[model samples]
Target: MTAASIVDPMFISGASVWPLVEGGKGVAASNGTSAGAWAAAGGVGTISGVNADLIDDNGEYVPLIYKGRDRKARHEELVEYSTKGAISQARIAHELRQGEGRIHLNVLWEMGGCERVLTGVLEGAKGLIHGVTCGAGMPYRLAEICARHEVHYYPIISSARAFRALWKRTYHKFGDWLGAVVYEDPWRAGGHNGLSNAESPDQPENPFPRVLELRKMMREMGLDQIPIVMAGGVWHLKEWMNWIGNKELGPIAFQFGTRPLLTQESPIPQAWKERLLGVAPGEVALHQFSPTGFYSSAVRNSFLNELYERSERQVAYSDDPSDADGRTVFLPYGRSNHGVYLTPADHARATAWMVEGFTQPMRTPDGTLIFVAPDRARQIRRDQADCMGCLSHCRFSAWKDRDNYATGHQPDPRSFCIQKTLQDIAHGRGDPIDNQLMFSGHNAYRFGQDPFYKGGFIPTVKQLVQRILTGE
Candidate 1:
């Protein structure tokens, strides 16, 4: 169960991936330096989560800059930014690679212009990128798209069944070109998760059988040689050695998401790293994101606390005449108007808090209004106008689609703009308890259980690779 026992050879498209990969994180958590460090170590490193054009002086990611008056014009700006970001990321990968490792790009399928943005980046960085990894949705055309560009592709899936669904539809045609398959644990991963309502968030199933089934499916589809990269909640080699030499699983590799957040080369704020040190097992929870309609994981901080409170207080509306309406409601402080609704003692307490300026107003993505703050509310509206229209039918947009379809009841107050929050966090304006929406694996609490990670040592990419490889 030591690191030496876990080290194994992993191959993708004739390239060797030292049995370890640094999973791609969004908003610049896994950037060139982090990915390069992994590549430098003879493993695969994925640069992801809206990569910045770090080549610009001042270390500021240039693509995030807003310009243009309309969505079309703004989208052009985004293309330019993404191109530069891709080049910058590729250059960093090449520099750190020393010509001995594999480097890949990770893109979320749900992101605005997913295919276009990724294509622009990949086209710009021709020889620099070895592969492309995508998750969050079933990328039905991924194999076709990558094949057209002659690039390798890896789809992140949670179960063997999902992979089978994809293979039957698209990847089956690409055959050997499909580089690797990533299985990220739904119950335990940072960022947007892949769980459905049918799956229980609290329960985690053994990954061994799931991986074996996926390998079997791949074999049946004539892809037995493709490696399976395990992601989410993977911290140490000793915990994973049991899967290394299993015959049913075949060639297996591991991908680390949250563990990489504490690396010196990682671009996360220092305070974020410090917070991970104090995390206990079960401290991380999987909840539905009001923004993207997907499950995501993160430490339960003030931001989450506020969201949870809102959910608890949410009341279902009924059109039946028996239902109470127009009841005396106390509005939160800074709300332009009070006396919205009140039925119970808790409603009275809410009204009291509002009168005392103890509460803020927030709007959901569905256009339902809840009081958050006058200042915060104003900021949300102002930030919404700057929207490059990154998402299709943004809930913030009171603007409708071209078909006169009322982008129906848009302008949700419950969800804040993801771009704004992520941008703020990336720029170091993040507060672990308030501003930043931190994402981690469900197993993040396991850090407290281990002695080696006591006090949350932020290791360098080199140190992480060495430790995982050596099993120290």
Candidate 2:
């Protein structure tokens, strides 16, 4: 894909930089090195503040090792770790940026103790980060927090409606610090998507109309000067030539989230980079199995396949014998041999599964039992026990940050421990890469199809940015 279209420099975060943004990825995929390199290349670089990594004074990587006895204590530990990691990464990015471009911190609003982590990092690393881009939820307090820190705020929204709610509720008062509006296409973006209940997962809307709506809303709110960062599925600039200088979508920029993963500056492991080139079209799909309760797109590897199969082996059971189907067949689950009511067909299925080594029937929050192998069941229970409160409220573990520290429901076995799997994949830990979660944008398939990336050639951050500028 080629075009003669040119992208002009845009003013963002008190600086004039290329209208190219490095979309932030989580679990150490996009870190200080990558963000700094991207900023040095004249683009707005983003450091993912989600469970970022840290380096000790000796310049050695310090592993995240939790020492808490309980989930609450570990949750506190995670907050501290995130705060320190963000500060450390910001300092690195600030130093490597050479006083050019902008360094923005990206965070998920659904992360555990998000406010505490953000405030703590800002307090510790003052003046290091020029802006903050947040999404994964309605972060109504983000604008005020950024204003207090004298940094710009970029709210990542999937629709104009979400941006309007934020502006009216909180951002309007701190309009001075509202740097940009990141329109992350929930249908095409990687990691956690921001699709609202009104949107359909199977139907992907054209981004042009959605962004136009957001720009119109901003214009009505006297925010026409604000730029809209188009993130997700942005592979070639030529594909977006029409949107470059479109008046209806004022002050636009493209954020390359998936395209940057294969760059030399990317913090992802070499194997992960290689794996990206092998992704085929239709392999990545938006699924609602995340513990955060948000839909995310990922490759259908063995890890995801297991989750898919786990959900398939489910059967709803009634604890009360007076169910509408009457006193039905019994399913003896758990070590106590407690019996639950199951319909005749479901009973047959459960019996077949039990015979086929799925002897463990774990209860879900939705009053259904999902059968799994005994070892798998134990792993699920262990992961639940080892939860560190990664999210504000994790449906998988029934761990909520407020009230009784639980979601008032049984822990679900359908979802795996995201923290553990992400950390494992990021650090190239013991698990095989296929058994861990690997995030990728819907356009990851193009990496293999594109000739520039042929023969395993990976370009530097500057090279990648320059190539994108060529409308390739």
What's the TM-score of each model vs. the native? 0.87, 0.97
User: What is candidate 2's lDDT per residue for 91-204, written digit by digit as tens?
Assistant: 888888898899999999999899998999889889889999999999999999999999999999999999999999989999999999999999999999988888899999
* True-vs-predicted CA distance for residue 108, candidate 2, Å: 0.5
The collision pairs in model 2 are: none
Per-residue CA lDDT of model 1 for 127-163, tens digit only, reads: 8888889998888888888888788999999998899
Q: Per-model C-alpha lDDT, please?
A: 0.72, 0.90
3 in model 1: Cα distance from truth in Å? 10
Clashes of each: 22, 0
